[model samples]
Target: MGVCPECRAATYQMRQGKLREEDCLRCGWLAIVGADGTCRCCRAAVRLGEDPAWLRAVLERRLLPAGRPLQLALRMDGLRLKTLPLRQTRPLTTVKLPSWARGRPAELQDDPCVCVTEVPGQLGLFAPCPRSFTREHGTRIRGRTPVEWPIVLAELKAIAAERGVGETWLVHTGDGARLALASRPPTERLVSPEALVDLPQMRPTVQLVLQRAGLLARPRPRLVPGWWSKGRGSCRDCLAWTNGNDQRCRDCQMWGHTHADGPCHRCGRGLPLRDGHCRRCLLLLAETEYDLDHIALEGGDQLWFGGPYAPHLKTTTNRAGEQTGLYGRRRLQTKRRIAVQTSRATAHTVSEHLAIPGQLLLFHALRDWSRLDGRPLPALTPNAEALLADFTSHIRARGWTLPGNQASLSALKFLVAHLGADAPFHETDVRLLAHHPNFAAPRVINYLRAIGLLVPDEKSDALLATARRYADEAPAAFQDGVHRWIDVMCNAGTRPSLPLAPSTVHGYVRRARTCLNIWHTVGIDDLRAITADHITTVLDTLTGETRKTTATAVRSLFRALKREKLIFRDPTRGITLTVAIPLPKALPDERLVGALDLLPFARDKLSLTLAAVHALGVHDQRGLLLDDLDRARGRLTVRRAGRLDRTIYLDELTHQLIKKWLAERHRRWPSSTNPHLLVTARTSADDNHPKVHPRAISKPLSRIGLQPGRLRMDRILDEATHTEDPVHLIRLFGLSPITAMRYVRAAHPDRYRPLPIAP
Candidate 1:
């Protein structure tokens, strides 16, 4: 071995690593290099003082954002690393109709706006946002539809010849069909295309091609009025003036014609006939068959009832639950394919708001609610009575306010109606059944669990939901590890420490997910595959507080895994982190100094006084009782969380504010049973013993662009400026030792303000 070095010295060569020859990435010259194909020629050129313009240009292109996608992407194809040209999707280009085509409907131009699309032998004519455009002059949407240069050039040549606005015009020479867009009405929002129901057309394949060319933006759904129909909310429930002279809806008109000189031929009843049958008969016919618009008689086809422009009946629901439609119609709709279907738009799409059924019955077997089926709610069962009694007791025991207590009961009733008589209840089903005005899912679940009607199967909160969502993206083993970690955080007695709050667990999961995502990008998914080096690499990418948060979350995950013996070793065992808390600054004098004068209520004024002057947190102020305030001693005692109560001598301003509030509180609730020093009508009106929520003390201040915590910090900081003692702050504000120390350090002149940590 020693003699080999002497022989190798005579060869005079450098052996860097096991290598393969590859073409230089930048230049055509062959180079002895690694798999990346990085060569010395480019480096040598730069070292020899060649212009770096090419390098600078490449860097900008790589680092800077190009609004459109890049042409080439570095990807691995099979075993080979290759830069492939990306497939760029073409977007739609919108153009107006030809001059020959008419724009809007004839009646008032009846809500005018002619929008149309066409394919070979088929044309789609639409009148969108007719209500808006009927009288107003045309307004243009700001975004421009991007067109291919070659196509645009040809289109412009024809437009230029005709001296037209090329962007808004499209003319088909072979078919002599042209669509000319007019400036009829200006719309602030995106418009949905409403089909010209009378003007029939269908060519789905060709439609797709044309749509791909003309669409600039696919707008999120907005309220666009239905054409030639009653579209307002009032109209859906027969609240608007009747269309078809006397008919409740288009469905009713189609059901039977009114007094067509005899009784209905089908039902043989002497009533106003629609399509030669009674309204009920026609509705019955619709359920069993299609083509109800044109009824067939023995002699000839029945006349079309009502005109095409009648309003459809509004969908509705009651105690039977909000139904989209019957299962028979739902299954049929799913199997449906594109045909010459009319483009219809209507509000009340959800139909949950229609608490009462409409007069007209909608056909087609979709939706359960019909005017005939609308029935009164059923009586509560013995079980339901017992459940409500127990739930009410539970609510009172927990000290729920009047509104909160009522909402839980209402939510239960809704679920009962939704499930009908026999369907079992689940936490998710309860959540989904809750409608607008009162989303009473969480409270309802608490009631159900307390009564033992439902088991706890779902994630208790949003944090677990969020963690589970991200965990699903990982490998099965890694996902199991994540969920296991969550179980530890959520379940009691899983750790020596008290169980994590939903919010805390949620935050931890979110941070852990961030690390997992970064690791997965580098081909690592399993927790066992991850090393301390991998964690270090992820930490380096995040800075300051983010880095610390990510580190803590990662360490927690690894620690949990190691504790359960799920992993061989904890990668985070040797890692130690020191994350600084950001300094708090005083609020501007102009903002807080005159806030008291601006405040309208005595309660609000006192709330501000406690926060800004006495350094009392919103929680502390909300928890204060009349007994806690000693007017003779001029002292105020603040109690928050489970900490020791802190008593302080009141300032003259605080005392004056308290005096004003005491007088007001006495006037407002003369017979109130609430023992709290500050009580609102909500807590005072009822003897339910419900305490004031933190929002009561904070909302008024929040509305005026002030925060209680921020004001408390400013007050504490002002005191800390006088003396740098943490113990003094703790005794004065009843802050925990840690928080008090943080306040002192933040206010120190030697300390510089850093970015605020997220939590």
Candidate 2:
């Protein structure tokens, strides 16, 4: 009864005129009934309008014997039936093509005698003879001559003669089409050029050809009443904006070149655009807009972009796509998605990406950012466009992909709010901004640092802040001595052979502060008052590792005070107690089993593997650089105390993981400028080569129920148990002699008995 939607073959729809029988509505395919189910033609192509009986009769006649099948095809355009068997291709019959619907009117043919061209300002859009394809698509043109060519040709020829321009250019044709387009009945869009880039009729390419040939008007600069904004203030002479608004203003106004600009086009102020049409106009517009639930941006197709700029949005519509109207609940069906269509867009098209008011405000900010900074942005996509989208719907910011994910937009917001009279501020100037809880500045700082817009920090703010916090917690009288110790420990002033790490310094002061706090509660706060008996009592209160670490901390505190002459005697002296060396236990076989396999990221897998198999410390893992991993040589160099201490070589697993992780890292952060091997979204934007934070290296391991410190110790202890020799442990792991001895002692307790148990 009808053609099948799929397969497009002619098929019966009902059986016995009572029940639906031929096949399902969707495919119209009934492969078999009882025995004969196969249909080869359906698989190859649709056979429309052919009588089933006729086709079968023809097929039987064409067969030579009880032989192979012949392939059949119909050339739709030519209405010829053809057959192919082995080698020869020949037509079998000529048939009329049948269809119920009307065919499209014939496409416009190009007329070489007529000119073709592009509309001067609109891109992708040609000077039609073009009908729009979709309300949604970008500028794309369809070019062909008009249906009423004879009349249009006569008109074009007359115009060409009058204008003294050649007939080959499309601009002239464009003029002809413009005059004739409306009168010609609405039909298929076929844009003709007088704007030929729109015909693409090239003799070949010359920009502004007709205008250059003096066939059309060329734009010239406007000369106005006050071309220069030389002076500001109400004029006493004419009681208007200009004192000279006397005669020339009237003349310019009459001619309409009127640089002789007048009062508030809205407010009657001399302002070119008084208060941008004043609060009164805004309220009036708001009153009207409030009545409607939905206002359609005519022919508006939305797109989304990512950019790094102050990201606060002034919502014309909420996230749900409802306008800010007092009445009406009408909502649009479509939602805005991050635009993946980064294929180049036009100046007009880019503005469509942002909300309307945001579009208006963002451009002004961008103009200020560009003009004030004295640096024009380079290309914007894949990076700056998105960054500043929350900032500019027009001009784009050009740089690497915005420095962060969700926080990146907010980061720019902070930077813009803090920008001074002179932009690209120093890291110190940005310090105040970074403290806001809602504002994330580090990612933007990393991006700015990469672009050479912000100066690098001399001393990282986090480090300085942490030190200051600990120093402030010291007991009042002991603060002076404590600051001195901290300064010495941080290598702030005079150089010592070795300086303690920030964590180590914190540990020392933290423990010392605990003792001081306890003593303060007991009213024996001063260092001079802390006698040996007080030290013994405090040491008695703490046990095991806590006792040992606290004793070390107290002794260091007293030693510093005595050296500084703040105390006469070191109460912690001669108060030493022997502590047992703790043995590293191997992780449970079950816990270690398949842990790496569970980690989600390649970077995490490699990080945990090095900690568990190779015994890398948290700091060591953070310090690893891209250049440190020598894949070809199967070597990984570890930096210790700013010097290369050991080269780990000889492993396939390490190499495999390194390869996988590097690939993943690069895939995720292709534009990363970080020199460090480990880069997260946080650190990838900076070229400064900041090491991955120690917590970053350990946190993932902790999340999956693993501990880097314990895992690392387990590795070393396992190695020591197998080797048994302390010297081997020292040499292989680059461990200190004392450290190796302790590990060896733990491994072979049979050789070194613990203190005899008092039975």
Candidate 3:
């Protein structure tokens, strides 16, 4: 039996785990069982040799109520406890003492030579010292003094418990030591601070003071390397004995060991090789390397290196391993794996053989498959049946604007459906399937051959080559002639005069393509053989802007061909089309007023004014900069398309709108260095200064049911109808003479009276 750590009884066994203490002998209390199978009657604080019990017992006898009052005593260097003569205040009709210090008013007695001070604002003796209690000469003395509040309270508690008193009082000694003594037992008692301190010294009458004054933190056990372990093992690299192997003991392992092999191929570590590399690199090498037979959908798949594919591997290990199956084989859909493999192989083959633009388009189609019809993409397998079905479904899912795009995709899908799953291209005669209108003619056959689908045959290859050129040369019979015609015009020095600007040539070619789509010409030779009657017949089908633009382009193409002597006769010789420009739609007074009223913010008002009153287009408005505004002159300089610059006078409302918006713009982007008047906040902090999206202006106007294009036209018509002068019309609306003439007819149809033709 031994002294219990709790209950102050000798009941616990010396080897408690070997012989459990069920109960304490004197108290008859059951011992509390611990996790380590030891039994304790009370906590360590109440034990015989602990600081708390020893300290409490020492203070109880000397300074507590032997019914004799205690005193505040001090030594020159510090403080000590001694007895004081009791003083009683004169009894009065009513109690003379203040309620707060009713029972303990005697402790407030002064000793001027001693310079006593109380820890104010605290009711209990052992309360924590606040900043107000730690001041000396109206300034904080926390780090300066040795005797702080915690130490003082701890001393007071020791004195109180030893004196058999429930309360203690403290005072600051003139020498800066705070002395405490038993005053009298009060109703409230402070918790003792002895339990909080964890230190080595524990004995009777021991004062558990902080190591540094005012520093209440318990000292933490210092940690040295291998403090808890037995002797550190020998170094792995040099096999030398060491206290701790962590730093390789510096001398034995660090400078002594060098790599037996060069650097590791995977991790680049210069260490002796386990299997031609470090153990870590070997493990990593196994995880990343792939096995086609047992491709894993999850991690930790073992990979085998060596044989045919070993040269492709960055590193290898001595432990040869092979993959048998996937981690989550049951959960992985078979079709998903096939689809992924097919798409990857197809993209790789297309990129290797096709032109850059075609490769990009095909890859985009693959990526945007799910978004094409706003539905989930169907699962596709690598087999021909599944591929063909998925390809058919994809075409029907969304409609494309260009026929050429649809045709190209159809051809690509056909090749992928057959050849993507490693089907032999030699056995699959793609040309034979061309007779079936469901698939496009063998355009994708060359792509399949390039990706190792075909078995080479010189005779068949030569025939396929001729067939491919014929297919490429003829797209649509009508389009074939237009392409040929454009090719002749594009070839430089073949023309009699210097070639027109590329943009002008592009416009002509565009119109020619449109014409071919409208008519039926088998080839370039067929178009060359067209009579004047045929040109007129085609032009008759078109009217207004289409007729004018198309007629001009066709006439230009034929004229160029005639000059080059490519055609014997010019079919467009007598074919002519009149340019007809219609009058712009005028906005109703109420509609205009309603749109202006609906302008929600300053920017909207500014954007609308540029579009409506100033007759600026959306493109021109977006290009407007701070420099374009001439505030002093009250005019704005605008750059229009076709390299045209126009200066327009700003009205008072327009000027104010611009000014207000500019002020708002400056406030939002105070540090912006972009030259454009409009800007947007960058989505990322690292992005460059942003130009406002075109939709920013359009979306606001659209909300108000005002179209920017229609507003510009309304402004043009307003000027045209009101002024009636062609010159004014040209200057204000930026119209050509021909366009102004059309406006003149609309404004004053009866201005030109025709004299009757007499017989």
Candidate 4:
């Protein structure tokens, strides 16, 4: 009890609505009451019927910031409103179920009725209700009939929704008529209740509850077009004219045929698809995968269908402006066509020796054949054809061997394959060639350009900029000094001058570039700044012949600089040559013979011949003609470099092997017009001779661990150790006296057993 301001005592009873006064029980003093239900003594009003916004505002103002929940609960008279702070009230969960519940079932006489609190409805808001009726306070409620479960559930749901509570579960208690109303939804529901009940119409309600419990899956709707059952007419939603009364546009329904992940790649049926293929297209996709697998397996061996060699077609025209085909261009094309056809036929043959992996690469190449035509090539000018003709004439005039002719033609073929026939050459083609793995070597590029096939592109950074860097970075005085030395060495007239070969000159230039780099590194780019110390650093860093070459190049550079008065002393003055006699590196006799015996005809014919000739003490092998071989005398007249020729007597083994090779060669190339003893497998020019490529001959020897130079040395050593007479050495192996002395000096002193004097 509290006291009012005027009265000393106050009543605790509250009254509202029309009643304005309350008498104090103790003193009988009347207290004034406001319509808002505020106590006159305490000046406090009941929280009932307060505006939701005002309540929220007051809560936000009074409550500490950390204590505020995302949703604030305002307990009004008839409604517990969940609201945002300082905002209006709105329900969070809106679960709207159809009103399909029927009347409640009657209680059974056989089963005892379970007493339960009556579930309240709309009146429960303002008035007190049974504990069972309030889902928030009670745990269980009982009903007599299971058939009435749907109706009871409907009522419970409505009550829960009105009170702003979450889900409630209806669990069977197994008692006569008792059911449990859980505060939260059950994870698993009991289906035995439905099994015992015989209510056909209420089965759906049971299903609904089971669905909420997640014990049963929701029903799937039938996938049918809405317009199928309706008559054909224009759609109201979209203004497009329709074949049927379809409301959706055709594009919308195109992929909506099924409820699966996506449309089937083949039949437009919605699906879970793979490789963009449906069941209908699966076979095609599988076949493609099989082919690719086989192709990849074959490609792993580094062989492809259009490989071994990429094909090219060449055509020749006569003076009458018509293709005369006299140059055998047509014949060559026919041969290539036959070869391709034969390869494809073999691929399809499916022989036991030729597996699927071997042929599948060819099949892949066939697939890509059509696209290869459009591949970009190096561009050339109209004068390129004339230049090529003139170049070929020049090569012939120089008396290059048949192999040299073939090599030049092969390089030209590579050029024509990328740049189409009639395409003019450009400097860009040189840069492009630099990127090629096989032809990109600096030396190779120099050869191609020297032969007039490639021209330098001044604008390109690759070759031109590199050339410029070498030129512009070197001081004019230094480059002039280097070039003057180069010219003196290249000149044949000067006394004490060793005329440099073209390759030697190139090597000197390359070496000078290295010395320039070292000079630049030491911050001395000028010729006058060059010291013996810088030259020594550059030479010391190099080893073997490279060091010797660099030292020589620098020595020449310093000598020229000194003569021009650019330096007071020679930078190369301290450099000295330490010449060491090279010991003969001859292969062991047994290993050499064993390697020769191991050589099979199918492996290589050129290597067999090369090894045999080496064993016969024939060092020179250039331009050896069929006439040069005297098979009757077991002898071969070999042409050495610089027109030095000699006839060497071949042993029985070498002679018989040479005869066998000649027979094999005839059998293999019956139509060959070449007169050279060893000729190229294919021809490029109209010349009658096409010698075997040096690379072709060298490949087998390299594989068999036999070096020609070493084999030649072994033959010379065998002869040198046999006799001390220089005449016998020179006559047997065709060596000069000075050359014989080197072999004699290398031989053991005991091996030089002189013949008994006049015995």
> lDDT order of candidates, best first?
1, 2, 3, 4
Cα distance off (Å), candidate 2, residue 499? 3.6
**Worst 10 contiguous positions by lDDT, candidate 3:** 82-91
- Give per-residue CA lDDT, model 4, range 1-759, as digits (tens): 232442222222221112235332112334443332223322221133333443453445331111111222333567533211131222232322223221123332222322333443323333222222121111223333444446545654654466576543323212211233221122323333333233212245444444454334434365445435456654332223433445543533442342235565655655434445432233333223334334333323222112122222232567886634312355444654565566554453211221121123322211122233433333333444555565566555544454645644544544554443342344454444445433433322444555644445455334333433454556554666665555565562234566656556556666788778667666775777777677777777878888887887777667755765657888678767664557675566676666765657732544455544453322244366788889888778877666457777777766776778788876766655566676555532224254556665666666887665666777777776777777887776677887887788677655545447512
Cα displacement (Å) at residue 484, model 4: 3.9
After superposition on all C-alphas, the RMSD of every candidate to the true structure, in Å, is 29.6, 19.8, 25.1, 31.6
What's the lDDT for candidate 2? 0.52
Which one wins by TM-score: 1 or 2?
A: 2
Q: Which stretches of candidate 3 lie over 4 Å from their true place?
A: 1-190, 194-504, 514-526, 536-548, 576-580, 597-603, 639-645, 664-674, 678-700, 731-734, 750-759
Residues 1-759 of candidate 3: C-alpha lDDT, one tens digit per residue: 332343222223222222334332212333433322223422222333333532353334221111111121222445322211111221122323243422223333433222233344546545333121111211112223322455655664566466666421222221122311111113313322332222112212223332223333344465444433455654443333433636344432333353255576655657555446643344344433433345543644333332232212122223455322212232133444665677766554221222222122322212222122322223333464464554445334322233644554554554453335434443234554444455554334533454555544345434334423432444354344444445555564354355455566566766666555444453433556667776677778877887788888888767766766766988888765555435556778777886777887888888898888888877777787778878999978877667568888999989898889888866765555567766554311112334567888788999978888888877877777777689888887677897787766666768854337511
> Which model, 1 or 2, shows the larger lDDT?
1
What are the models' TM-scores?
0.41, 0.49, 0.38, 0.38
Worst 10 residues of 4 by lDDT: 63-72
Candidate of highest lDDT:
1
lDDT of 1 by residue, 1-759 (tens): 111111132222212123323333344334443233333434344334353653453434321111211122223347432221111211122323233232223232212233322233432356533222210121221111222323433544554467654333332220111111222123322111332111112223213322433522253475544554553222221223433434355554443342353576765656655446654444444433443243444554233233353323222345777523321344233322111132112111222322232234353222222331333334454555566566677666645555755666776764454343233355655665454345466667655655555535545566667777877866555788888887777763245655777778878888888787778778885788889899898898889888988888889899888877788999999877666656789889888767888899999999999888888787677778888889999997776555676887998998999999999987766666678887887787544446788899899999889999999889998998888888988887777897887777777858645439633
Candidate 4, residue 567: how far the Cα is off, in Å:
6.4
Model 2 vs truth, CA RMSD: 19.8
Q: In model 2, where do residues sit more than 4 Å from their true spots? A: 1-424, 434-440, 451-468, 471-475, 487-498, 642-644, 752-759
| Every candidate's lDDT | 0.55, 0.52, 0.49, 0.48
